[model samples]
Target: MKERWELMDDSKIVQLYWDRNEQALTATSDKYGNYCITIAKNILGNKEDAEECVNDTYMRAWNSLPPHRPNILSTYLGKITRNLSFNLYKRNTADKRGGGEVPVVLDEIVDLVSDTDDVEKEIDRRELVKAIDDFLGKLPADKRSIFICRYWYFDSISNIASRFGMTNNYVSVLLNRLRLKLHNYLLERGFEI
Candidate 1:
């Protein structure tokens, strides 16, 4: 089924939100709630925090769309949810109570880049995004989901295997192959190390 966002006009949704229409909020939730939850849960790990993040994202979107008619509402919502979840995670970390899954997942990549270096300098975010999109576009739907679940969503291979009803060994081998391909692509794009 085509996503509701793919079917409905984003500008219309923004207008409805600006008009204070409750149905607009309902429609937005109906369309993007799951997506927001997925992003938040991936970052926050805890269902409670994820739910809070998703609610916060909706409120933010409701307030912002009046002034900022977003061309891509889903992406905007996702970004807000991610930023809010990350901030919450940082606060927890500062309090020495870190518990989110994303922190540990991102830590794996932290050592790969110099602490002082900017991410943009190592890889142009736009170019990297485009490359990733192109790579994903070429993959079969199942393979693409596996790739996203493992790398983008930072799900462990064993976790992903369980989710997809596959063996861990199969997931591991598939991930290894995808990683090699991505490594080569990044190298060709001048991403050193």
Candidate 2:
């Protein structure tokens, strides 16, 4: 029943997906649907677009599960929702500018790394990701979580402040400091920032 499926833990739900059971989809939606919708809505700024992105995320997960088993289901789902929402937001805003917390977040980090107009300056995405991962690993837990929440989840400063019980200005300051640290770290690692 629906209630029973809702009671299942993440690992069980993931197993159902691995087994190709139809109920896996239901369980995933039950567990992560709202979370995905929130991520999509934050980026796309429309309920309809968010819903579409969430649905697409489900489809993407279904297709990719056979070859990919995520250790953290929520993080995996959130990443998919965020990426899909970003792509949709980009296409919709091609004629205009995006208005929301998304723009604020982007503007804050835009200076950390310069735009790669020349193909020669483009680093392999995997290497860049590895460097970023190493940097995050070295950060204190609270700072790392704040950074992930702000950038990875596209969460607004006010929302992050509320969640972490910090003042909005404090959260903003922390994020700025983290960005500066990341920029210096990347530069020391020979990244073209």
How well does model 1 score by local distance difference test? Answer: 0.75
Alpha carbon lDDT at 57, candidate 1: 87
- lDDT of residue 86 for candidate 2: 89
Residue pairs clashing, model 1? none
Residue-wise C-alpha lDDT for candidate 1, range 62-164, written one tens digit per residue: 7887788778888888789888888887877788765646765665444333232477555565666677688789889999999887656667667789989
Q: Where in model 2 is the C-alpha error above 4 Å?
A: 1-3, 95-98, 117-124
Candidate 1, 9: how far from true, in Å? 7.7
| Per-residue alpha-carbon lDDT of candidate 2 for residues 16-70, written as tens digits (9 for 90 to 100) | 8899998888899988899999899878778888999999999999988878889
lDDT of 2 at 40: 90
Worst 10 residues of 1 by lDDT: 108-117
Top candidate on lDDT is 2
lDDT of each structure? 0.75, 0.85
